[model samples]
Target: MTADARPSLAALSAPLVARLIDDAPALRLGIERVGGARVVDAGIRHPGGLEAGRRIAELCMGGLGRATLGAVPGTAAWPFGVTVHSAQPVLACLASQYAGWSLSHGDFFALGSGPGRALARQEALFDELGYTNAADNAAFVLEVDKPPPAELVAHIASTCAIAPDNLTLVLTPTQSLAGTVQVVARVLEVALHKVHALGFPLDRVVDGIGMAPLPPPGGGFLTAMGRTNDAILYGGTVQLHVTGPDVEAEELANRLPSSASRDHGRPFAEVFAAVKGDFYAIDSMLFSPARVTVTALDSGHSFHAGTLAPELVERSFTHVP
Candidate 1:
């Protein structure tokens, strides 16, 4: 697909951004102007909760998807969960929601995710997806405790070819309520990312749905990050509909789970610590949903792989002491 033929993620998500700003008080999100950009505080100063995160997750997908809170059937310890679905999985999950754009300046560092990323085209992934956006406004989701520096904000606006005031920066802290939900909400995105990493043809993916148990917010950053990761690595499930040969769909199902990674057996925090906190050192394959089902749309055959590890999820969620 050509970049010109794709839908503008920023344009599609504009209504979501407006809804977020309009419902800021009810959602407990703090709205302010920082570095001339509209910053939506999902957790930093506001008491943003699960609903706020759910909405933010939709925004993260450029409003091409839906995220809902629900119960995890057959689960007791962790009953709450988030389910996500996207019809345009490649554009929504990869081009917008994947957190592919890395932004940093001084000691401040953040991975920018959302519709604005389509406008900037900073990451090489956009090239693979053959997508670009032309919009008057852009919105970005940054998982951080503090506002971005003025220089960094200016850089983001400049790269997106928009004025600072036309930019919206959403901050979601790792240890906050909104943070945990938003992070876990990436279950489908994780599966889509793993599919890309496995060299599967992105154009074959037609639709996808994923869900993961929502763990309680951890007391600190490390613990919080671990629980969120474990939720997907152990407790998550994904189903992808694709137009492809049954054998290819089967192979994709087999390779698209966290269990296929060399770094799979333990909690992510342990893996992180073993790697000395070097994210690059960890196995890229370990960041996928625990279980997956790939259905070949043309053949009407479904292939399944991996299993949920409730024990590991329980261990990670309870290890916060």
Candidate 2:
């Protein structure tokens, strides 16, 4: 698609939101009219179902593709999986899925991700991607235990240059089922971010697909956080189709997995504790899928990296033998 013909993320996702509201009102994923803004609560007040989680994951992709619930090939404790596919992988994953914004107001804070980030244009990554979008409406996904307040919603509206009524926010806490699914759904985003961090030209990436085990929910925040992180760090895998030089594709493939980091080979929870809960203190390269494959569309050559650490995944997931 040409630059001018590409649809705004919000525009592309609005229909999906409407479908959710209409099809599964019982899921309680609806538009909240607060302070003249609309907030879509996926997990906060209501118990967001697996289907809602799937839709929220798709929303995170800016509706560029789909995220479906399934199972990994050979896993027991972490059998559930979220499979993602997108034609515009760079635009859908990096431009929309990577949670790059830290939003806070008073005591409320959440890492904002989704179509709303494009509308806000608050990160330099957008500039580097040569992408900017504007829409009368905006949408955001927030990983938070509580719903955002009216003031925070208004602040987001102002940043997006949209009226409060034109904004939509989706909330999910790390400990919730929906939250776990959505985070695991970020397998592709994690791999793409790793490639970008390695200085790979993202424009060469034509398509992407990823899958990571969906962790069972019920633990407190930190435990749940660890399991989700381990789902990607130990069990996730991604395959990216790229139209780039074969050498560059090989380099990206080598560097695209979590094992490339010094921080690899441990449960992410242990690493988090070792860093004293300071996320920045840990190696940034640790946040990636367990395995990655880069296919050079031009040369018909493929490069693979890393290996799935199912032992670590079992260790982190449960105590059962």
Pick by TM-score: which candidate is best? 1
lDDT of 2 by residue, 245-272 (tens): 8998998888889998999999988899
The CA lDDT of each predicted structure is 0.92, 0.86
Error of 2 at 35 (Å): 1.9
- lDDT, residue 299, model 1: 89
Candidate 1 lDDT over 131-170, as tens digits, reads: 7688889999999999999999999999999999999999
The reply for model 2, stretches above 4 Å from the true place, is: 28-31, 74-77, 319-321
Candidate with the greatest lDDT versus the true structure: 1
How much does each candidate deviate from the true structure in C-alpha RMSD? 1.1, 1.8
TM-score of every prediction relative to native? 0.98, 0.95
- Per-residue lDDT for 88 in model 2? 89
| Ten-residue region with minimum lDDT total, candidate 2 | 23-32
